[model samples]
Target chain A: MSDHQPSQKELPEAPSTAPTPAGISRRGFLKGAGITAAGTALLEGVQGFSREAVASTPKGVKEFGPEPFPVTLHINGKEHALQIEPRTTLADALRIQLNMTGTKVSCDRGVCSSCTVLLDRMPVNSCMTLAIDAVGHHVTTIEGISTDEQMHPLQAAFVRHDAMQCGFCTPGMVMSCVSLLEKNPHPTEADVRYAVSGNLCRCGTYPKVFAATLDAASQLARKA
Target chain B: MNSFTLADCSTVEAALSQLKDGAIVKAGGVDLLDRMKNGTDTPTRLVNIRNISTLRGIHSTPQGLTIGALTTLAEVADDPTIRTQYTLLADACGHAATPHIRNMATLGGNLLQQLQCWYYRSAEFQCLRKGKELCFAFSGLNQYHAIMDYGGCPSVAPSSGAVALLALDASVELTSAAKGKRIVTIRDFYLQPDANPHRFHVMAADELLTAIHIPKPAPGTRSAYQKYGEKESHDWAIADAGILLEMDSNLCRRAVVAMGAASPVVRRSHEAEAALTGKPITHETARAAGQASMTGAMPLSMNAYKVQLFPVAIYRTILLAAGQMDRDPSAAG
Candidate 1:
């Protein structure tokens, strides 16, 4: 499974390494030298940071690849046992297996926050996160937005301010907003914008999103 | 791209042991996996270390803040210790990538984060740094590459957090099962792509960034980190400045100036630091410091804009660190 375009390194010899002092570490160079450079370039154009490991080239699509290991995802205050292929994302486990589809998945690239979830109370793009690595952490998805019988103030404001259209980007936006508020309960408009820049809504509800966040801050402050 | 194995280690020491040879440690995977997704790294076996308790967190000691290898950027930015002791650091962390990215991107990962060059990202482009036939960015879309490369590789070091930490003079704890343990300065942890663009660090495959130690700021000191980008929301700096300055009777006794995305790593402008140190942090001194920072920029065709942008950033950042805007310079001394 290698891309054969050979744009980067036209290696006369396979890249290899042995232990050496003051030399390059010989590992983590995936070669699918056959994938068109255009495909990789397209993916790079629209992206954000993620912790998911990616192969340099696309592995053939296979149905139900056998589980690599049994990892537990602690999502929304519950531990779900999952036998996942190494490639299974934390967001997929949340939506597909746990049936808590509150965290939306679009673009599937790390760039879009549609799959944003809180890993140990911090926001991360879940589509790019592997389930195995999340085994021992607290992950709060959009499903985890409500606490007890009450919705988080941010959620209330998001709905009150009409912060969604198709609702796909809402979960990630809300999660990002809530994470920001967890630390900076009173964020400037600029802060709100910066916090949710990773998330995108085709509906372009950003102004409303910012308004909802500001509204949430005021309400949280009042409650305090 | 799909040929890889994921191996998990519960302890840093355990992760160090997983390496037979040619194994790369996966921390938060924010940077490494992004590179992999973009065709930069293809590992046969990845030794996972994010779950290692010893490798995450920020703790204060008499020496100063000790950031674990897996300590998330969010933790660094939000930690009260960092906020109080290292304001510039807090500011830089606050501005890193985005809030979502800050969650999983570790401090170690951020400093170790490789260059984000477009040519390097492409699987098809040939660049001189990847031992390629040519460096596309030399004449291509290098507006975001580097401004300095007197050496070999000319890719910009895509590290905002490192710029802040470099100002703080942080040190790294490198531990490998075979090499035991050793500490390296943050300045030493990074390399210019010209030196070797294929890998970012000299730390061994069996090694783990056990911890990063930042010494307490010097007495009577102030620091600031300011960056210029297309926009402040979630963008890499067009030009960035991190300054750690020590003052004596309102005179600039010393300063450390580091500029990022202008070089392979957060580059310290000793010339700039020397020009401002022990001076009265005057507008003239600040202007000279900025000039010093911008000097020695060997910008490629696409990034001359940074040469202009960085000088202004450095001047502004130094003044901010010197508390120039808020004070009467005549009364400051």
Candidate 2:
């Protein structure tokens, strides 16, 4: 099939009050937006803007900065205010600022769920989530899963089923399993596999991980 | 990742205002954060539009299904209405990325997400997609490159949502502070790299994708999506196909076939659709339609295997859509 190209000339004219696409080049627009090309040097000049400049900026205008600022992150039912750069990820903030080093940062990208955490009860890669973006949401890490130093049922099951080898992927594996069990207490083996498919264990402990998650589900059921 | 301000916008109007001056809109941040970490994207500021309530739900409209831009892939897949009405989309969403990614990745973001090309992602090679003169994949490793050459750039549009939406005949509602609001069909939204190497879609920088609308299919229409990947999990499709067929007493009334991963864009196979329309959907006819889908495929040097894989992907999806065959878990191979 022939590609359909929407004619630019046929597009309706923009409103006078609307922000015109006059001076903004496509390269310039894409460089700062969405999932376009990446090069840190493209935005290096933004670091020099002052707070006063930001204040004087238009209501809808953006202010760029690499400078550290104080922001509060509500994590695991507690709010911790810390000074961090806008680029600081939830994983980095938890590990470096608050000393909650339980959330591992292996790939540091979204691919590896080593830094898996619950952002408003949904599993998300903490390494890819910016600290500032997580401000209003509930952030639950591996360290927060337990209460009063007692291992969560999922964690206890992991130990029981020997769902660890090098133990690097355990924290993430446990967090993912906890989320699955919360949503589905009686998941099939296929459900368990689909739940933790994002969490990679180089140790090849998937069989044990599955066993532990199932056992934890049964345990939680009995307790209920 | 480079340092940038995070601008939190509470409304669509506010988000559009901040979308100017090298400010990128971020929702989910699955793809944006990954590109930032790879040093491929350096925005001066990130306009956080996640708080915009209007862009975060799924509703049925008189026209059809209207899905908010920020609706996650998991939500779309799990939505009972969508699962029953638009099974192709549900299957595509269920098979895309992984559970964690599906939870974080939004439908709008998935549609506009960048291709997962190794050279394009790597800082070492300044490929054409990055505004360079050359396409490194042409000379380097291109095993995952597009089989159909729609443009100079070899990277495929990696959205399963896009592939399924094409078969469903969906349209996107785009709103910009400048250009009030306009609806464009999914087929007209994409741009080949040859036409414009820099941008993937026709959306202006200031425009925001508000929602996706899938027109209600004709009665008795069934659809299915089949994706072929190297691995069972966490891998992009090597080639995928989505088939939508409207049956009239065991005879095909209307057929729409869309292919992805094999092409730079989610493409409709008009030849395949023509071959099946007004014909009985038997095993032989389905195979014939699948063969017709490969009319103009021009595989890259390393991706020649897709020539063999694309037809089977299309055939299986057609069978599944026609209720001729059960969904095989190992179809990706």
Please report the candidate that would top DockQ against the real structure: 2
> For model 2, which pairs clash?
A37-B40, A37-B41, A38-B39, A38-B40, A38-B41
lDDT (tens digit, per residue) of candidate 2 on A1-224: 22232232322222324333686655335434532232243245344554554666556444435676777777776677777777888887887656576788898877769889999988988888888778778898887787554889999999999999999988998988899988899999988998888888888999999999999999899999
Q: Tell me how large the interface RMSD of candidate 2 is.
A: 3.8
Query: After aligning candidate 2 to the native by TM-score, how far in Å is the CA of A146 from where it should be?
Result: 1.9
Chain B TM-score for candidate 1: 0.92
Candidate 1 C-alpha lDDT tens digits along B16-73: 6666657676787777667776776766566767667777777889988788878888
Highest-scoring model, TM-score: 2
What candidate 1 gets wrong by more than 4 Å, as runs, is A1-66, A96-100, A107-109, A146-156, A165-167, A180-191, A201-204, A216-224, B1-4, B326-333
Q: What is the C-alpha RMSD of each candidate to the true structure, in Å?
A: 13.1, 13.1
Q: Mind giving the per-residue lDDT tens digits that candidate 2 earns over B1-333?
A: 876777777788888877778878899898999889898898868888877888999999887899999999999999999998899999998888878888888999999899889998888889888888899887788998887765788898889999999989899999998769999999999988898898889999889999999999889999999888887778899988899999998999999999888778889989999989999888888898889988888887788888888888888889999999998677541
**lDDT per residue as tens, model 1, A112-156:** 788888888878888778777777788987666775467788888
For each candidate, the alpha-carbon lDDT, in order, equals 0.73, 0.83
The DockQ of predicted model 1 stands at 0.14
